[model samples]
Target chain A: MLQEHAKLITFFSECKELVGRKRLQKMIYILKKCQFPFSERYQFHFYGPYSEELTLRVQELINLGFLQEEKEKKSGYYQYRYTLTGEGEKFLDHYNLDMPNMDEHIEKMSETSSRFLELVSTMLFFEGMPKEEVEEKVLTVKKKQNYTSEELQQAWNFIGDMGIQH
Target chain B: MSYQSEQLREEKVFKDPVHRYVHVRDRVIWDLIGTPEFQRLRRIKQLGTSFYTFHGAEHSRFNHSLGVYEIVRRILENFKEHPDWNEDERLLCLTAGLLHDLGHGPYSHSFEKVFNLDHEDYTREIILGDTSVNRILKRVDPKFPQNVADVIGKTYSNKLVVSIISSQIDADRMDYLQRDAYFTGVSYGHFDMERILRVMRPMDEQVVIKATGMHAVEDYIMSRYQMYWQVYFHPVTRSSEVILTKILHRAKHLYEQNYKFKLAPLHFESFFKEAPTLEDYLKLDESIVMYYFQIWKDEDDEILSDLCNRFVNRHLFKYIEFNPNHQFEQWMELHKLFTEAGINPDYYLEVDSSSDLPYDFYRPGEDEERLPIHLVMKNDELRELSRESDIVEAISGKKRTDHKLYFPSDFIEALSDDSHIKKRILEILEG
Candidate 1:
């Protein structure tokens, strides 16, 4: 599960720099089906519905240096191509494959620090609850903790600084 | 805690597009914004008919008021940190900035012109008179409200506090420029506001920009210049103002002529008689004007009905560039042709000229007191902006003016087939 989470994060982070959300989602779907070093002709089937916003997002990704685009002359048409760089591949490898834990303290810290673990745990308990229910749960937690207003304000500030969603 | 101390509440915030958020830690500032008098700003358009040109610019004075407050808050924060800034005058500066536009009525410029009502006088009245804003201000200190009024009125001796809210590049102008740009969705009106704030220094008499940030100051001036042309002086906006002025004129004229209307002009009745109280003025906002315009669309007066429909539906008068000096003869000929075509030249045809000197280095004996923007040098010597910067020098003291003649294109198009006057008017318009 740890290896799977890392792989998903690496895949998203790497692809997000190259393509937009919709295209990246489609690319991830295709990769799950056919694996990497994707065929140019095979990807052409997915490029039917392109939008200006998508193009802009793709261009932004290209500017960010995540994906490299190549073009090959084929018959009477130019076949556009794309590939993940060495850096991207290394990121995926580093994140996906598990390693032997040298320090128990660091390993335990990583487990708690993992956003994916936290998200999964929270999702398991409150799978299809309404927003109000989630809010109520948060309020109940606050009440149970008996947090002061200043403490709450500090927590809110920390959350804002960390760019964490409520 | 004492009862009076308990009366004081925690900070309140209004999510504002211009200033991001208007923070009101003081009980007085928060209450002033909530007053019925101040709440009336929400009903008055900030740009006054500029929305007729820039469709997205439908923001009210309420937006600007909050923006002004935010800018003042930021200024006060900077001042509190600096030794040169007076800690005592913090509340005065903030209050003045927040309530600066308190006196403005709906379409203030036109209303003032027609009715001879001075918004500045009304602003003073609202602040010092028996009002909620005054009561809250007096709670701070007895003389506090008067000081705030004096600062806004430009009668205060403390130039430092007054300049923050009223000067050439003060909080008011800074907020409006950015707020207007954001609402209008224009890129030209953006200057590095963050940089400007960082470089602003509180001086003995006035606030001055640090000499190092001259580029930022130049950028601000350029933004103002662009906003003036692109937003403020937009010919379409002027055309709407023209139509609005004509509508008011027609209404006032009809009232004088004893012409009975379907619905009596309740809001405008006092204005027609050339006397309006503070209560009457407060009740008049963009909505009231709009309501009147809607009702006037069905009026028996042809000009009033036509103008009202044009204003409401945004069928604004089309304009062509014309210099009165160069095209005086042509203008007369066009006016004659308009009359021959059964179109009233007085109401339909108008020459509107908009001009502004973007930045002036110095004008020693000028009637309009414009303090030349001074940049504080590294060596602590003050140098005027144009002296050091080439870009600013090139544009400094240069006043640019644009003139355009507005007329109803639909009227000309709908003329009878036998009308040669329409052809003549078209020739003048095209030329």
Candidate 2:
């Protein structure tokens, strides 16, 4: 397996099961921000950060029967659930991938709502900017989301707690 | 006193074959167009080697840039009355539209592959660096340049603004499809862009098309599909690209080996070293590249001279359908035979694959999953395009790929028919 694809497969192996397309995108982006060896490039879309490279890699895994994807219809929109298949587990058992212990972080992020993760990822996208500036940008760009001041502070606190930002 | 609000005394128009007239009413836009950096676009071919296949595809990035700006201008005009539209981002959209392709080097896709450079990175550098375009943008506001870069980079805070410039059915694609088709004289890129633009609504997050305009959207998607297969990824163009890419590789390899050229590759020096300054990058365009190709035909290095001669004279490689997976043994045999036959398989043979997903819904973990086009259905509901249109649904999530083994058939043909090596090679190639 390709190194990049293996890294993602290892991520799946650690997390066990992940849900929601938007949530998956945000989780990977936030992990990338926290400085992992994953090398997928992301561009900010309406849904915070999205990587077409990651999307394609996951598709390749699914096509190879190394990953499983289930589409669940919810509230007139479709949500995706992802898990490592038996082949994925068997393949992983063969390759000794040296990855940092990230199960706690992955599990915690997996439980968070996709909407909040979207905010966190967006905030991380503007991570270099001043706190006030990032907030202003989020408020302006995400006017539709109606993320309140309280929510912004919560995101900032979450970033600190996650050690995403000091 | 901001230059952003500066209006021209009269609307300036450039006679565009695709957009009819590229009208510029903003002084900032007019001046930015006059900058030396922007003017360099005229030297870069829009379709690169596509002109070899489509004789009339001799248009430049200058032509396509204006077409994109014109499309964005028209879209903004329609967007003026929408409640979701913020009027202030108008100049940013126009600037981003016009300057989007500013960083494209000569034969952009091929050059980027060889040099490991990105045009988008160059674009950001040009906008943010100490250049005339950057200076002009700064006259608007200190942050204007960054905002424009962010928009082009698709990281702008305003998704609605970014969507206008780069969404699935945005001005960039609309312009290129029409302009490339018009120049290539292909019928595949024609779609009712006017209808698509009219139905375009600036939603809170992204642009959405009215459900009534689904047919036009469908047509646009089909146009893109056809254009990719028939025009963009045409095998003849790919063959030329293969030769061109091989030429760049051979040249770079020779340069690394310190093979002295009769004429110094001054323009490609920075690119060869993989650390091109903005000035170094700007100095190179298609004309400069072609000049090098014309001169390097007489180079001391055999591979460099041969490849350069081929590219300059349009003596492109011929190709046949090849699947490396299924034909690995045969491919290895051919490689060995080619080497025995005194043809360097590395420089002389290649397998190029082109794949495209014509249309796809927002399927998580899918290949080439762009933000799926959304339709504003009746009763104020939003639906993904593939869900609404059968034409789109049939092709959704289908990725079509073509792999071809490209090589100089003339080189193989020139070998003596009586030679067993040539005979076996021909047998394998023909098989």
Local accuracy of candidate 1 as per-residue lDDT tens digits, B1-431? 42113334567777887667777777667777889989999988898888876878889988898898888888778778787888878777877888999999999877876676768779988988888888888877788877887688654656677778866577888898898999888888888888888899987677888987988988887787778778887777888888888888889999999999889999999999988877787788888899999999999899889999999998899888775534666877887888888898889987764421122222211211235567788887887676788876665542454567888999999997667887777777887
Q: Which number leads on DockQ?
A: 2
Interface DockQ per candidate: 0.01, 0.17
Give each model's clash number.
0, 0
lDDT of 2 by residue, B259-300 (tens): 888888888888899999999999998888888898888887
Report lDDT (Cα) of residue B293, candidate 2: 91
**TM-score (0 to 1) for chain A, all models?**
0.28, 0.96
lDDT of 2 at B296: 88
What are the TM-scores, per candidate, against the unseen true structure? 0.69, 0.82
lDDT of 1 by residue, A1-166 (tens): 1222234334444433332223333333333322332211111111111122222223322333434555456564333345555644554454345432223322322333222222222222222456445334333322333434454444344334333344
Q: Give, for candidate 1 chain B, the lowest lDDT window spanning 10 residues.
A: B356-365
Best by lDDT: 2
lDDT of 1: 0.66
Report chain B TM per candidate.
0.94, 0.97
lDDT at residue A139 of model 2 (Cα atoms): 81
